[model samples]
Target: MNDRSNARKEQRKKRYQRQMARQQKGSKRYQRTRLNVARIQRYRANCIKNMAHQVSHHLVADSTTMVVALEDLSLKNMTASAKGTVDQPGKQVRQKAGLNRSILQSGWGQLRQYLLYKTFQRGKLLVFVPPHNTSQECSRCGTIDKASRRHQSGFACTACGFTDNADRNAARVIARHAAYGLIRNKQPGQELSTVTLRPIPY
Candidate 1:
């Protein structure tokens, strides 16, 4: 799907460039190409927004979990330009630009906003915990060493030899933070409190 989208975008770019070079700015051909590109962009935006709505609604209404916990993320800061001033330019400008584009295209903010409203409307408790070190901390032994998450998809705790998928571990850490209000120095199941909330109809 992404490949097809990229192909269409590239084709539109070439067509638009060609039309701009040959046609006058306000000519029919130029206006047509501009409108075509705008339509494509609007379609993509609607697709992303619809997907975000579906995912968020499903998470709140379809899932059995009453407590929804999400990491408090600053998408704007995450996608901000890494390029500094001309005199003191930043490193990895191209890589950061691509990363920022990818992040924006992922619709993280849209999903979060949908979840916020849906969760509240459904009477489900939604909590946003600090995102700091949720990925680096070991979910098993509570170790905060960065070496535990040496790989993107893999996590192995250096302190206790605990191994798990990186994303799953981070999720567990987030759940633990939500459940116990602490991320470290706690025994398994200690200080953890779970209160079951009756499902409320929307």
Candidate 2:
């Protein structure tokens, strides 16, 4: 999927540069190329929107699911430009730019918006939990040890020797937080309590 998208993006860029170089502004050829560019952009956007709708619909349509929990992700902060002023240049600027592109292309904000509206329309609860330390926290033992996250996809609890997929463990942590009402009535950006959370039984 990413490869296809990247190829299409490259094609579009080349087409746009050719149009700019070979066609005069306001001419018929220029207008035609402009419309083609716009069409490609609109098609990509619609594809993303349709995928988001399908995913959100499936989640909301689950019969046993009454509540949906999501991380309150701040995309703006997550994708902020890493380039700094001349006085203090930022490190890993190229890597950060690549990550930012991936994040933006993933359409996370669009998916979240679709989920929000669909949940509301279905009369279900949609809760957003703080995203801090979720991947490092163990869902089985409720241990918050950073060393447990030894790999990108694997998570092993240092305290209880529990092992699970990193993403799944993070999701379980979010579920426990929502189930325990740890952040009820709390404003956005408010810190969760430091009290030890009980392990949720699967």
Best candidate (score: lDDT): 2
* Native-referenced Cα lDDT, model 1: 0.74
Task: For candidate 1, give the lDDT of residue 134.
Answer: 88
lDDT of 2: 0.76
Best by the TM-score measure = 1
Each model's total of backbone clashes? 0, 0
* Candidate 2: tens digits of C-alpha lDDT, residues 117-162: 9889988778777888987999998999999998978999999999
lDDT of candidate 1 over 1-202, digit per residue (tens): 2757756875787777777788788988888888877877787788778877876776787556677777777887766656656986677777778767665666778888888888888877776778899889998888899988889789999999999988788888877776664335357877644543321111
- lDDT against the true structure, per candidate, is 0.74, 0.76
List the lowest-lDDT window of 10 residues for candidate 1: 193-202
